[model samples]
Target: MAPLSHYLVLSGILFTIGVMGVLVRRNAIVVFMSIEIMLNAVNISLIAFDRYLGQHDGQIFSFMVMAVAAAEVSVGLAIVIAMFRNKPTINLDEFNLMKW
Candidate 1:
């Protein structure tokens, strides 16, 4: 069995990649994907810790995170589609929806 530290390192690497994607990418879809990756990274860490501690709390919290991610995906895609219909582009830089 792999050590807990290995799992933690992998999770950290995945999280770092996700953060970089979110920061460096301009497409809304890519950003959403990155967010999902970040969420999964967190889930991995939670499960790892749960296994290490022999408790179910981490698994339960991971499920909650998944549920929230699902909701976020639905709402976020809807908003993206609406914005694309109006402007024909999904570039984050082109969006000024909140600007007056």
Candidate 2:
């Protein structure tokens, strides 16, 4: 079995990559995917700790986080679609309609 440290390391890497994606990408959809990546990283850590500590709390929190992530995805996608319909592009830089 993999060590807890290994799981944590992997989770950190995934979270870093997700942060980089969110920071470097200009497309709204790509940024949204990056956010999901970050959420999954948290889930990985939650499951890892749950395993290491022999408790169900972490697992329960992980489930809650998954639910929240799902809701976020649904609402975020709806907003993105609306923005696309209004302006025909999903570029964050171009989404300056509210700045006027």
Candidate 3:
């Protein structure tokens, strides 16, 4: 079994990676997945904190984040689908629909 600190460290690393992906990736889908990764990483940290502090606040926050993530995924995927139908590409650079 891993120690609590180990989980926390791993979660932090994952969160960093997700942030980097969001910053570096030009593909909208990749950015969306990176956001999801960040959210999951947060959940991991929240669970670890919940365990360490002997409280349910982190767990409750995790649930709330999960709900928001679900809605975000739905809306994000819908936009991606719509964009692909119009432009046939998912690259952010190729999206000039809203650009001047």
Candidate 3 residue lDDT tens string, 1-100: 4678998999999999999999999989899999999999999999998988889999999999999999999999998998788788888887665955
Clashes of each: 0, 0, 0
What TM-score does model 3 achieve against the real structure? 0.88
Full-model lDDT for every candidate: 0.96, 0.95, 0.92
Q: Candidate 2, residues 1-100: lDDT per residue as tens digits?
A: 8999999999999999999999999999999999999999999999999999999999999999999999999999999988788789888998665975
Model 1 C-alpha RMSD vs. true structure (Å) is 1.5
Clashes of 2: 0
Put down candidate 1 lDDT per residue, 19-41, tens digits, no spaces. 99999999999999999999999
Error of 2 at 85 (Å): 1.4
Worst 10 residues of 3 by lDDT: 91-100
In candidate 3, clashing pairs total 0
User: Which sequence of candidate numbers ranks them by TM-score, best first?
Assistant: 1, 2, 3
Q: Order the candidate numbers by lDDT, best to worst.
A: 1, 2, 3
Best by lDDT: 1
